[model samples]
Target: MLFGTSGIRGLYGKEVTAKLAAKVGNAMGGAGRKVILCSDTRQTSPILAGALAAGAMQSGAEVIDLGVGPTPLLAYATFVEKCDGAMITASHNPPEYNGIKLFSKGGEYSKAQEKKVEEAVSSDLKKAPWDKAGQKGRKDFSEDYIKFLIARVDSQAIGKRKIRVLIDAGNAAAYSIAPRLFEAAGCSVVRVNCDKPGQFTRNLEPKPSTLSESAALVVKEKCDFGIAFDGDGDRAIAIDEKGVVLPLDTQLAVFCSHMLSRDHNKKFVTTVEASLSVRETVERHGGRLFITPVGSLHVADEVKRQSAAFGGEPCGEYVFPFATPCAEGLLSAIMVAEIFAQRGPLSGASRGIKAHHMARTKYKCRADMKGEIMRKISEKPQLEGRLSTVDGLRYDFEDGWLLIRPSGTEPAIRLTAEAKSEKKLSEIVQRAGNLIMKEIESAH
Candidate 1:
């Protein structure tokens, strides 16, 4: 029943299972309305998705299956078809895990609505009479998705360049979508681990360590650029044509710069986890930067309310508000491609952008200790920092900041630190982790 920073995610069979997924579906309700559903290539996803669809049908909701695509594809489909949606994927969680994420008609879900869905599932509400059962159908929206992406860019410009691109799907759902999009955009694609509907060939996260194979592929293939997608394909990490991995902050700056320069007066929304440099970049370009709590949902919600041009997290989740009200890897990739086409190599384009050092350290603090740790951190008046309890406890200092929050799905706490240097970032992260551990031990 745990909902993480994204959605309901947990270790499969242990905390998440088909039966529970079905219950969640029933709670969300199909009500004879079309509901778009999709899943990644996780081993347990199809089973859990089937149960979820059954429950939705039992609740008299029609299901449109967008098979084995990213969560954003499902989100896009939900908006295109004007249907509520659900995606069965644990995103960047490990192979042993799976999850379910619900989206409203516009591919966005608020915390309040998420709670409603959770409560509905918890209550075990009954389905409508059998005579009102909903139907199920299937569709391959990948082609349409590609077409939509192509429409956003000047295809002629991209084709003229004939960019050589390397793609690492991370054995996630993007295996089917990314290569196709690149090819359709007239890029000569060099693919690695692009297999769809198979075992995860790499660590689920698309971070640098997990994407060494991608980097090697980029260098070996001499590709123009490299891209890596996480499990559900909502987040993307990029490797320059030189086979250098671009940090999230630099990537955001690139995206924001392109967006703002192309369309002035656009607002860029981000979380506190975003580098302070991003805020400076946006402001320098006559655009405003809106900071929210850490989490895509929070950013997405703010984007919708403010009609912002773009939104993203430092962790690589990028959202184009004009496209859909959710972070979309496909869309972000297309935007990156356009940036490449317009500005040449990524390395050349990323010049003059302020770069900062950041590090994330996670600790195993049981769920029971989270509250005590929060209290102890809050009581430390000597900290002399600005504190935000938005997602968890985030303390902002003059030169750095740290966020300590309980993992929504795991019995652990996530600690993120950002500063001017790696040494300082690491020092603050370790200090925060130690202090939290001490509090937990004392409480126990």
Candidate 2:
């Protein structure tokens, strides 16, 4: 499929090109359709964005271009403007990579929607007549998006407490807006790596390994906490007061716990790859847990379908259905600050949440061989657990579970196994690794 779990993403000039972007735009265009378009800070973003706009215009789709904005902004704009949305971003991928993400009704395109686009891209798409072609216009909605967030959050409480925060935009799309959003919310904002758009001083993905510098700054500056954003600002990673970066699963659990505490509705959504800790914590709060395949698109769709209180991924992508349908990192950051404002420190909230010993590893597999390799592995002997093949192969055991799946965004197979005890986790990991390697060898 041209579309991955999230959107159509790959290396810029190779897998993702201007030609492809234009084709996608043309395929998605229709008469009287309004599409809100934006791009991240990648050098090639402008080219792709323009090509997409051109194609859409040729097909009679009115395009409102928000030249350089984050993915969250594009999503919000789509809802506010009552139009479909398109964002040119590779998300957390490296600089050489770029991709296009399409949104309809304020969320990523559903799998069925994506399938239609793929089919149209392959076929001969029609264009509008000379006078019937659409027009392009420009506007900046950064301030409006900031206002929308501020209106929903406890800005007064956040400001009253004067929560000091360090925001690491990673020199990408969120650089401009995040600082402003936090400052408006009454936070004493400290900015780093927010200077330039295309110049990156750190790894784009906001993980523990990539956030050391930001974490240290949070401690040194005596801030309440810190937030680090990924390349396109769709994901956020938090740094605690003591310069420790919170684990993705732990942070997700904390967010869920906080949200459940706020509303009477206990419907929460998380992905299949989420930690057992998340499930336990949600259930403890009398929240109903819903699991979907490993993608924010799936999470968002499930959230809307079930009227979920909140949805999040272990990777820090959170969807606040009440505020917007998209997985919003900017909103997640502000919500973290509000947690401190309404409650106490995050350290206190994270105290009782359990942590598990989990092992994760990936094996390289040729992209074209993924289907055959997965088929061979699925045909192998079963493990001792309840099995699920929702996104991949998952076996749930009494004390732990094992999951083996092909990476949706890369040419590899990922294995995740978790257990109550370290020894049990190690055993599960060993067995899972052996199974994957044996199948891969046979396929080769």
Candidate 3:
């Protein structure tokens, strides 16, 4: 079975069933003796975690269930508890969607490890003796996790700025941590939709379209900026003081530039979907940029392999190698503060990070036809430029780039192109999208 870009996420009762969760738990339990479980505010999370615990327990693995926590906290708690980690969450997905995330001490489970788990669930899984059934225990590692995260940043530097931030948690797991973290760092914290439950008062994912309310609040409250965390708190999107939601790629570029300035030779990891501005910013600061196929785990593993200090995705996933591999919103919030205190506000700090015009669009197609469509697109001899098929088909030229890839989470083909100007970007995007649509039609 194919997994999404991240984990086994879907509408809870349908695509992600309790039986499926248990089978995955049985597979995951084989990795270690003590397994730590974490979850978010989704109503189905607790139920799924229970089912997973039942499965893991029967596999002779002790379950350390940490209920209603963020994804990254689970990743960090693994070191403190000395155990492997699993999280029940569907990061940034719809409120009805739920999934599981797996992690090792170094980081998220690698592709090879995911494949192993996938194979186990597909076949009859292993089980231990009745006498050997592992026991279940509970722990809340949030406070310890908060302290550990605090040590990773320069709180003194951030406190000097005394930045006041407005956070829209979207009524998810971020509501549990972001306020406490900013307060601890000496920043005045204002909450919008923070105290609400997991039912989600707004769209779970924070995007430009979904942030009008937050943007207006930031301007009205006179905040330095605003933050909106996705449903699981593993991803975050930001808005500037002027009620302007910052462009995702430019936000990523600013951080990459700052991180590279600290250590010129350090490697920076980002997904292929990242903008040309990322490459420009990293190279301009004398740091090497390593591109990987999309997926937070993929970027995390690549960061470990390349000894990269920082990794980011255009979709707001940020990874700090020193603390943990998972993308923790609380850490990202402070890191954003530290950068502001040192460099300037995001609006000012982003001036140096020049970005090219980009056009991105998607066309719906059946999942079953994706492979055939991709194959035919690859066979096109008339297409130009150096092609990189690492994730899909990415063609690079002197002034621009075009990427056509099938969405792992949906039955659609995503096309993205970037160039120096809007006219060029639109031209490339249109041509690339038309070509892919032809393949989609031909696949039928």
Candidate 4:
């Protein structure tokens, strides 16, 4: 009940509540010294964070609250303070939802650890004595986190390009960091909807429909490119200078190309849902690509397993183990700038990446019925293509692929189809979507 692919997330005051937060925190059962605690700008973040801290305190763990900021800051703080951390953020979820993202030993808690916590959440455990109760404090690591970010990039090299950039923080978590990260990297940064609070002015998801205005601004201002972040700043979607939203696969392929050129490591890791372009780019560049089940934790775990130097998802989450294990969207934008500086324009890097016609659609399916629906789908007649059930059913062909997976974080079935031709891609999506809907109906 307390954990999912990422963490314990749900609609605030509903599936997620102060009571559940405390229970889960107690179940986490670690007296992590100098535990770093943080939250996003969601109205319920503070109350949830407080409940989480209280739970940890009961376990004799001190809490160091890092106020409001993106999740990556909390990740970075864990490294600096050599402590565990927790960020109360529902990430890209809608404003009414919130979550708890736990950090341990420098990265997210492992699935095994999460299972233990889940078990604890179900059963009560001993609490600390009154005299041994944990302590609570506060820290302002925003400045240090920014300083750390500035030191990681070649500011001089980035400044040489004099690149102008547009940022749409979505009135979410990155509002405070995106601008600073770019400006510090010597890029002229323009921002929109970075200040409104208590409500997200736009949809929290960084999709083309949601970022249309930001994309238009890039073209209007003649900015080199635009970067948009989700509610928690972990997912980043890019818009090109021509006002076209850069497809997630294209971003992954371009960045993977950059990492491949460095010769540091010939290894890249990505989610199975990633576009075929990313896989081909990595292979063609002499880098071995490892595919993991969807989820940032799964990607991070695979990266560690394979000692991959770089990892990312098609959805714009990048994991550079050099900085921290968690995905960092703001840093990804800076990395894009550095890539542009060295590679001239993103078009140059993207030119080698072939674009595919892709369609993504979602159908509402209750959480309880998702499993049976998938089972029905698996039992349906086979297609004339290779099928992979690693994370979901992915039918692969030479020119395209289709992936149908239940959303781990939402009550919906996600359908993704891609092909070299638009008409074929649409047919694939439509056919698969109809089949799933039928199964969902049959289950009912």
Q: Of the candidates shown, which would achieve the greatest lDDT relative to the real structure?
A: 2
lDDT rank order: 2, 4, 3, 1
TM-score of each: 0.94, 0.97, 0.94, 0.95
Colliding pairs, model 2: none
Determine the C-alpha RMSD for candidate 1 after optimal superposition of all C-alphas.
1.9
After aligning candidate 1 to the native by TM-score, how far in Å is the CA of 283 from where it should be?
2.5
Residues 1-444 of candidate 2 have per-residue lDDT tens digits of 799887988889999999999989888888899888999999999999999998888889999999887899999998888778889999888899999999986788888889999998998865999999999999888898899988877888898998999999988999999999998887889999999888988999887788988888998999999999999998888888988888888999999999988889899999889999999999999889999999998898899899989999887889998777888988898998888888878787787789999877899877778889998888878567899999899999899998889988877899988899999998888888988888778777
Global Cα lDDT for candidate 3: 0.82
Predictions in order: lDDT: 0.82, 0.88, 0.82, 0.83
lDDT of 3 by residue, 1-444 (tens): 547777777778988888988988888885348888888898899889998988888798999988877777888888677667788988777777789888877377777888988998888866888788889998877787778877888888888889999988888887878888788888998899788667688888788888999999999999998888888788777788788887889989987877876554469999888998998888877788899998788787788889897999888889887877776667887788878788877788887878789877889888778888988988887567889988889888888888888887666888878888788787787777778888888877
What TM value does model 4 have? 0.95
Model 2: lDDT equals 0.88
Off by over 4 Å in 1: 421-423
Of 1 and 2, the candidate ranking higher by lDDT:
2
Q: How far is each candidate from the true structure, as Cα RMSD in Å? A: 1.9, 1.4, 2.0, 1.8
lDDT of 4 by residue, 275-331 (tens): 878888988878898888888888888888888889998888888877878887767
lDDT of 1 by residue, 1-444 (tens): 356678888789978899888887887775657778899998899999999989888888888888788988898788888878889988888888898998886566777878888788778555768788888899987788789878876688888888898888877889978999999988888878786455787887877787777887798898889998888999888899878888788898888998887775578899877777788888888888888887888888888888888888988988776677788888888777888888889999888798777777677766667777777867875444688887787888888888877766566777877888788887787778778777777766
Off by over 4 Å in 4: 29-32
Clashing pairs in 1: 30-61, 32-60
Error of 2 at 113 (Å): 1.5
Arranged by TM-score with the best first, the candidates are 2, 4, 1, 3
Where in model 2 is the C-alpha error above 4 Å?
Answer: none
